[model samples]
Target chain A: MIEWLAARAGWPARWLLALLALIMLAGVVILAASIGEMPIPLSVTLASITNGLGITDLPLDRIQQGIVWQYRMSRALMAASCGAGLALCGTILQALLRNALAEPYVLGISAGASTGAVTVLLLGLGGGLIGMPMGAFLGALAAFALVILLAAGARSSTTRVILAGVAAAQLFNALTAWVVSTSANAEQSRSIMFWLLGSLGGVRWPDVGLAASIVILGGLICLCFARTLDAFAFGEDAAAALGVAVAPVRLILLTVTALITATMVSIVGAVGFVGLVIPHAARFLIGPGHLRLLPASVLIGANFMVLADILSRIIVPQQVLPIGVVTALFGAPAFALILYRARPST
Target chain B: MSLEGHELRWMKHQTPIVDDVTLTVQPHETLGLLGPNGSGKSSLLQLLASLRTPDTGRVRLGDMPLRHQSRRRIARRLALVEQHATTEADLCVEEVVQLGRTPHRGPLRPWQPEDERIIRQVLERVGLAGMRRRRWHTLSGGERQRVQLARAMAQQPEVLLLDEPTNHLDIQHQLDLLALIRRLALTSVIALHDLNLAAMFCDRLIVMHRGQLVAEGTPATVLTPALIHEVYGVTAVVERSPHHGRLQVHYLPDLPPA
Candidate 1:
């Protein structure tokens, strides 16, 4: 039935699907804002949003407006931005490395960011809220540089790049664990543990703004290189034959993806599975064309995170779970299903 | 495109694989390189395609030295199709062909109607229009070879370099692919293993033995049974085929121990 529809509608169906996904994303955003211990009604949320935007003259109470516009909206926007950024990073890494199993977390950028953020948190770099995110960003950049240095020695093959990412991830994970153990403060340890497991809790409007800029800029950069990414699907030599400057292009793309991944990780810890899962889901929906694959992955990723966040809010009333935990709960089963289905065939 | 390899030399791990060899290919001509295994036919092809640099000598396309040309510029003039197809992801046939336009496209440009027209024409030319949307891995070996050919064709290159293009193809596909290439009339440098097929398709044949050109001429003048026995260590009867107006070979089996 899908194939019939695809044939009859031609390429327009792709646009239609994207439109439907955008509508669904808007619904998810609205629904996410409405849920929580202090439930905000849809009408009140819309009014608060308009009032915030200076679109309506309705006189609403400031506390309710603040809760809706400042807190809920910030968290929801962070969720969407993180989702889109991570998914875009995954898509670029998968194409650049030509590996189906690649993701930002799997490649060790997340672990590196975590170790950096944890160091700041444990060492008490600053009392300011921005300390952890800033530290994480720097750490993510360091890890990215190390991976590039390791992978650059062998410019002809992708084996070194994948191995370098693996090594970096493992080393950082161990370092993070060591930092957590040696630290004396109990509160710091608890904060570190929560950060490592990932969360969308305590997000502010500034964090959302930062994440949105990084994600949109990174996604646009990736889209610019979509044709090069397509060439990479045929492997390094074929890509080179097609006139792609393999080494430089790969390095630029790796840096871009790492930067975006680090930005998202800094904002919301290391949200796993969204990067790995959403790309595969998007590929299944729209073939492996990066042009379509990218946008679809973004929409689906945003939807997935919002849904997971909503589930986190509702699953245990009066106590909100970390959004990352909810994603793992849902993503693990889906991953298992894909593995079981793929195992026999392979 | 006119390609000139001036005394090309290549070494692997300090061991010389291709000795000083010079050859020139003019536009609108097909040059076939034939040799035994490890005779550096593939290496020379790679050098010509600029995928690898020659150790000691320079290669030039027209008046521009290959070393001076950017990868994209070289790719605009020359396209290469290697024997092996290694891909980690599943891409559809048309998508693979569309990738050939990488050199012609800028970072921000969308796909134009001209690009689609070229892809369509190349796909039809290779008789792969019916399987345009099929996953690359789902195709048969012959179909994969044709798809690769289609991809190279989509490049709109002035020169095409192929390494063992017919490695996994059936006889019919082998003939069809060569016939299609012949009709394209682009300057092509192909490394072929089968002498009879090379004789039938190539305008000129360069035979290599131990990284050196042993003979260079039309097949009828260069491919005698004596040279074949010396280079290949096989006894074969050579004769002209009635159907194709080209030389054909019939190999004689080795006798039992006596």
Candidate 2:
């Protein structure tokens, strides 16, 4: 049935699916937001969201309103944004490299962010609201610069760029581990470990606003290049013959992915598997056209992250499981299945 | 109007690979580019198509310098079918042909009726009208070659550049492919390895020897016994065929390691 639906979907049907997914995602997000220790009802959660939007009066008391509006809703939005951003980046990277397995981290941007964030958490660089994310974004830019320099010096093959990224990731990951292990106190170590594993606790409204804007804006910019990305499926020479300026397209996409990775990592600390897994699943669901795949991946990824966040909260009776742990628990098996199934065709 | 280049040169690793080449393809001419291995046929096609920039010279389409035209403008008027064009995606034949419409449309333009019409006509022209839904990985080598041709045709180009297009084709498909190119009556330059095929279909033949134009003229004027030996380093007899009235080259086998 899903195959029939995917095969029959025209432009109108695809847009309709996106619209339906958007509506379903809204319901899922609200229901998940209602699932915590406070245990607000779905009616109250919807009412709370509507009341905040000035659509209706507050149905819940002050404490209930605060919990839904100030805490859970913002966290949910952040999860959706991060998921959308990471998956979109993965989709672009895969096309750019022409490798099915390429993800946001394959370029070492996230590893560089981890190193910077760990250093800030341990040594207290700048020691304020602006310091942590700023440090991490800078680190990611530095690593990306190194990657570009290295790739330019070589033959400019996609494999060579990927190998260069692997080297950079190893170096940055080692630096991150050293920083965390040697300098962090036990209490700091506990908090750092939870974050490294992907925590979404205490992500307030400001982070949600910033992240959602970047994701949506970045997605729009990427959409403008959807045809160009499709041209790249046949490799750079074919794309060039089709009037795409290959170097600029590649460079702009790399910068965009790096920025997305840096921002998401700084906010939620390296939420692994979302980038790698969501895009492939979306590709399977929708045939791999970027114009369709981009929107579908965004919606599907948003749903996945929100559900994972909900599962993390409800798994332990009182404690929150790290979101990355839950994603990896599911993502690894799916990744293996994608690889195993891919062997007979190519 | 013609598509031509002047004194074009390109270097690879500081060594000249396409050195000081100049040529012309008159309107509706099927110019055959013939050369020995490493003799710059492919490099010259790339330069003419503006897929590669000349280190020191210019290509002109009609009266305009190619560098002055936008990439889109150049692509709309010129199409190139490379020797081994490949795509890793699981696209069907129709989707692959639709890609040729990229230069004709902008990011915001919806796929139009005219574009669809062109796709359908080109697929039919290449004898793949019924195979539009077939996936790329499932096709045979000759089918893939025809799909590439269909794609190039869909570009609606004024000048079509092809590099070794008959490399993977069966002999029948090879003949059919050349026939289709000739029937289309587009300004085309084809790089070919088969000397007799070039002799049979091409309006004029240009021979490249060591990155330079060694000879250029009508098929009868350019193809000769001595020229084949000089250009290909092989002994060959050339005579007009009774059936087609074109110079037919029959190559002599090499003497054993002597």
Best-fitting candidate, scored by DockQ: 1
The residue-by-residue lDDT of candidate 1 on A119-228, one tens digit each, is: 78777766666577677877787777777687774343555676888898989999899989998478877866786777888899888988899888888878888778
Q: Clashes in model 1: which pairs? A: none
Error of 2 at A126 (Å): 8.3
Q: Mind giving the per-residue lDDT tens digits that candidate 2 earns over B36-125?
A: 889999999989988889999899999889985677788788888888766657788998899899999998688999999999999999
Report candidate 2's interface RMSD in Å. Answer: 2.2
Query: Native-contact fraction for each model?
Result: 0.80, 0.53
Top candidate by TM-score: 2
Runs in model 2 lying further than 4 Å from the true structure: A119-131, A145-161, A343-346, B255-258
Q: What is the RMSD of candidate 2?
A: 2.7
**Which portions of model 1 miss their true places by more than 4 Å?**
A1-13, A120-138, A141-168, A337-346, B208-215, B220-245, B249-253, B256-258
**B220, model 2: CA deviation in Å?**
3.1
